[model samples]
Target chain A: MTPHLSITDQPVDVASALAAVQTDAAGAVNAFIGTVRNQSGGRPVRRLHYESYDSMALTQLGHVVAQAYEKWPMLQEVAVVHRKGTLELGDVAVVVAVATPHRAESFAACQFIIDTLKQVVTIWKREEYEDGTEWVAAHP
Target chain B: MSLKVALFGITRDIVGTSVIELPAPAPATVGELLAEMRKQYPALGELRSCAVAVNNEYATHDHPLRTTDEIALIPPVAGG
Candidate 1:
């Protein structure tokens, strides 16, 4: 099995993530890259600081991969890489890649991996603006 | 007995520490630990929702916590 899950403080490498999920049997590969937007909810963001419970996040990431496989049995491989720590605008923060025998399944699996990861993983991001900083999705 | 709970994100900021040591009774459930945490740091109550992870997996409120269990406070996640 390919290395399908990771959490890093460095920049997320989209190419490597796609490469990891590439296989000879796969006829289609889909990749999703999430970058730091310049603004959020009308406030200009200076940067983003991401944090995670490393071990727990990794374990949850593995579960996400397993879920993708369970949902799309045709998926040949999957890679999910989430970047932590400070990131400037336009920096790649996450990459999800999936390969399968067909395009539709690969795309669906990739989407499911990212969507499930955001819900279940123990990772958070703090949006820093010129005036102040706040943890995203923290308040009720 | 004392149990050390790992804190992250807003919980860490509210508690002002990455790891917190709480005086928990033996055979404590995750709900009990969270109650103690909220009592100590009431600011945690402001969160919309949070999950408790025991030994790297999401734990139910009634899940029993051992002294050696790796406990983590998972706040509302926003990672993509």
Candidate 2:
């Protein structure tokens, strides 16, 4: 089967992705979703804005999937989605899902995807507060 | 000659865009070029860790730069 990896700016539908990637041969599906929060440190955030170099970000996401496939030859499918634009508290910003014939491969691949995405992809987030504003580093 | 550079994250936001081409001095080190860039773009100096990359590969401060090559100052990688 084809590798079902994707990086999207639209609101990701977990249901749809789960259906599309489910296979009889694959027994486990691991997933992760990053959500917008209402606060950062001591500041109370009113809203959050996310932006990215969309085409380049997707290309980097694809590279992460390729690396996962290489490391876990049993991996069946993968998908990584990221939201771009204004987001509020509790809104999902990123979703990474992986499926494999066993639980360990799916778990490891999903973690790898999120870690790689955070490390390499070109995405930015701006936090807005009532008193001020700031841009949070997507990583350390 | 023109030396193109890739800007990311806060650098892109403060500059209001990315992928800029600026004039380069003749045969300068990456450190020298960055000093010139910081002068032209004062906002970049505010960043704590602006990494230097030559031709898409990361390099140290003293790496020599060529007029015909691409140079980019990338802020720290923050994605997760």
Candidate 3:
């Protein structure tokens, strides 16, 4: 089976991520893509620099996937990919995909994975504007 | 014992190093280590929040620390 969680500096490939969770038994698939927006909190974003405590981030991601599986037993598989390092506006920052036997479960599990990952994963991003930069927390 | 703690994100920038070694009290728990870190690096206290990880798992402040444990300071996460 492919890894259920990953943290990398390379661009997140949505297709490959979807393929990882796809299975013959799966009747539904859902995905969530997080992109670097042009603006945040009314500030114009020039770019974003992401960083991670890679080992810990991967461990936390596994916990998130495990929780999703426990909550939705019908889920066939889940894949979470997060990009680290600098990214320009509009670049994909992260992707979470889930495969299940039904659409509702797939969507719910996908959302749960991303939400929990954001809360527990050890990743951080520095948002840079034209004037300055600041490290943003997952929660306000 | 001297314990080396890995730093990330803003913590790395504030301490100006990726790793820092602290002379921990004997039989130190994560709480004790955090106190020492705060005393040494006041900037860490200014963050909205932070978490401690021992051996790649999220650790409670009461989690015991050994000389061999891999500890890291995890500032607030922002990943999607």
lDDT, each prediction: 0.88, 0.74, 0.87
Q: Return the top candidate by DockQ.
A: 1
Report model 1's TM-score to 2 decimal places: 0.97
Model 2 ranges with Cα > 4 A deviation? A5-7, A138-140, B16-19, B24-35, B52-73
Q: Is candidate 2 or candidate 3 better by DockQ?
A: 3
* Highest TM-score scorer: 1
Candidate 2 lDDT, A1-140, residue by residue in tens: 56555545577687777776788889998888888877889788998777676556666677778888899999987876787777888888887777899898888889988988887676777889997766776334
For B3-40, candidate 3 gives per-residue lDDT tens digits of: 88999999888889998887645438899888888888
lDDT of 2 at B20: 73
Decreasing DockQ order of the candidates: 1, 3, 2
For each candidate, the DockQ is 0.89, 0.37, 0.67
lDDT of 1 by residue, B6-49 (tens): 88999999999999887645439999878878888898988998
Ranking by lDDT: 1, 3, 2
Give candidate 1's error at residue B10 in angstroms. 0.5
For model 1, how does the per-residue alpha-carbon lDDT over A39-113 read when each residue is reduced to its tens digit?
A: 999999999999988888898898888877788878898888899999999999999998999998987888888
Any idea how many clashes model 3 has? 0
